[model samples]
Target: MESSSHQDSVDSTPVSYESSQHSQLSPSYPRAQTTSLSLSSTPVNDQAHNGYSSPATSVSPQPEEPFKAPSPAVTRKKLSGYVGFANLPNQVHRKSVRKGFQFTAMVVGESGLGKSTLINTLFSTTIKPQRLYSQPGSELPSTVSVESTSADIEENGVRLRLTVVDTPGFGDYVNNDESWKPIVDNIEARFDAYLEQENRVNRQKMVDNRVHACLYFLQPTGHSLKPIDIEFMRRLHQKVNLIPIIAKSDTMTDEEILVFKQRVLRDINYHQIQIFSAPIYDNEDEETLGENEAIASKIPFAVVGSTSLVQSAITGQEIRGRSYPWGVVEVDNEDHCDFVKLRQMLIRTHMEDLRERTNLVLYERYRTEKLLGMGVAQDPTVFKEINPAAKMAEERTLHEAKLSKMEAEMKMVFQQKVQEKEAKLKQSEEELYARHKEMKDALEKQRLELEEKKRRVESGRPLTPDRPSVGQQQSQKKRFGLGK
Candidate 1:
């Protein structure tokens, strides 16, 4: 009985061990199998002998399953929480503010057109000092001279480097035929300087002294553009952003200004001069579109520039304008002048646009022409942006055309070879046919001669010619009477 009980216990131990091993091999029963193996390794009699509780009684029957890995095909997911990446505009704004900005503007017109005053009024600061003419007896300058003034201004912690280029003695001469030459030369010189800097090895500290915008102040003649104005603009329009302004517009009535603007525009159109206008974009809001339109409607802006403060009679407010006996012309008043609109477009709205156009359009054109003059040629496709799909299609088309050309050449060669072979074969066939016909005719003539010989033999005729040769010849000679 004791041996049988021992045998039964041994058999039960192997069964439990095998079950634990099987459970350990299965993925879903890892933890439960580990616990069962640990508990089963201890003997039950040893636990009772040591007065210790069996660990199997405390073990759980089932254990939680392990986590499975996600599927490889799963890509998109609905995020339950936020992850921040929406501050790009703020970052750009901060960087731009840290870098600051720079702008260069050129003012071109005749003397006493209030160019200096207009620049001062635009920036709300004294940019160019008032120029004092020489005494009445002193000689004036023979030609136009370019004057440049620079200032660093700051508004709300944003710093700006502003440069104003003034052209003096432009139309003051009686023979102002070459007045635009000096200004044009100066602008080209700036472009050359920039190109030189670009060609240098180290361009880190390059200065941008290129003139971006040119404000051409038109005289309030209540007529059309002057000859000098037309010539100057025609020369400089391609090099700079041309902004036309009517100086001292307060002198002309609103009706006169309107008619004068029309005449000036007509002249500009007739001369094929390009003036700077605000660019309209499709994505702009309605307000921006309307604002741009309003600004454009006031082109060739008629303006009155005054730095003096005058109290308005109606508003009882001090405004930057000139006081007159009859009425005051406010510089910031839109109804009185287009000074505010001009300032808005120049400084507030289209400042960057002006710089961009100058660099991209005007400067690039000049650079291209200069390089071409210097014998430096460039491929038209260089630095040009191309769409990948279009490029692929173009390559495919070229490949197809090339294949077609090769196929055509191959077909032409094959046809020529075939024709030559046919001609050779025909010649050989004709030669064989002619040789066979000649052999056949020889055989037929031989047969005819044999048949005649056989027929003569059958009829007992002489086989050889009855030429008793010498005797027959002598007899014939005698009969002919002189052969001897």
Candidate 2:
């Protein structure tokens, strides 16, 4: 009676009333259609309610939609105020300044070509001191050797680590056939060092020892390039940045220097030897473009280097140049020679460009060849970019193909099972039919015998006359004494 009364009270309460009560308790919460709310006035009685029936109410949950990723199209946004990210250049500048910079330069030429003087003049420092020749009757070095010098220089809070590689005794031998081999081997050795560092597990302290520029000093002979010059440039051009310089240009007149530069360029072009030139960009300003163009126009620069300052012939002002009886030739004067242009391109403007070209072009080419020679290959798709949509589509296609194959296999198995079942049922039906026919034939034969016996009884004929019984045959044998 108590259970009946409790069920009656529950049925009297409407769902709307319960939902209103829940909303009054928690008004901000949203009520979903599939949500169930139950209220019990007392404890559940397990004995009163059958175990099959639950006391709580439950609602089936609706299936939710699958999540989709956002589109990959880039969206540009405009900011109203200056953000700190705009100062990224300043941050990088501070970091780079704090870390400092490093650069390596190589100079290759024969002895007494003023290579040491030119290097000292270029950097405005005694990086390579003047070498003292051996005394008379001393034996000379039979082979060329490479020498390197390093210095740390700082100016206005910025520091630079400069390395200069010098090739002495080059082109000094009587048979200078293999003079360039040592220089080439040294450059390759630097490249190998850098490659080894890159392959190391800890690369945070990796150093860049690769050659960035090669300054090949040319003899001021007032003629075309020699076979040795052409051969050296041709062999070393691919390995490093080649900057051909006409050494000791004060020895030749202006007309002769001009004619010699043309002839040297002709020979270089004829031999297809590449030389480093300043690169111009489309977005550069007019001043920069003009400056780069002027720099490029003075390729194969004719230069003179001197540490001592001399007075100018016209201005009477002290300048860096050579003192001559006829007139003073200023090293910093564009009218005198191409020294100022060479310095501008090499140090003031294109130093970073040289480093970039070496790392991205020259070093990369050498590394590729080295790796290929060592049988190291890279997959073409290793660093390839992937599109999310395209990748998803490809995966979906593969999944659909797999599903199709599985479905075909299932259908084939089902058909085979159905065929086997049909064959078994057909065999069973044939066997049942044969058993029924045999039973019918036996029943018909029994019915005919019964009719014949009834006919024999009605006609009053002796049933025993058709076939004698075994008891009657035994009695006749005993009577005739033939039973034994």
Q: Could you give candidate 2's per-residue lDDT for residues 1-484 as a string of tens digits?
A: 0111211012221111111101011000001011111122233322211122222222334457643556679989999998789899889888988997778888899889888898777766677778788899999989888887767765555666777788888999899988999889889888888888888898888777788899999999876677788889989988888888999999999877776666666556556666777776668899988997787767789999887789988899887788988888888888888988888888778887788778866787788788878999853222234556767887899999999999999999999999999999999999999999999999999999999999999999977777779999999999999897
- Per-candidate TM-scores read 0.64, 0.64
| Global lDDT of each candidate | 0.74, 0.74
Could you tell me which 10 consecutive residues in candidate 2 have the lowest summed lDDT? 23-32
Name the lDDT of candidate 2.
0.74
TM-score of 1: 0.64
Q: Could you tell me which 10 consecutive residues in candidate 1 have the lowest summed lDDT?
A: 26-35
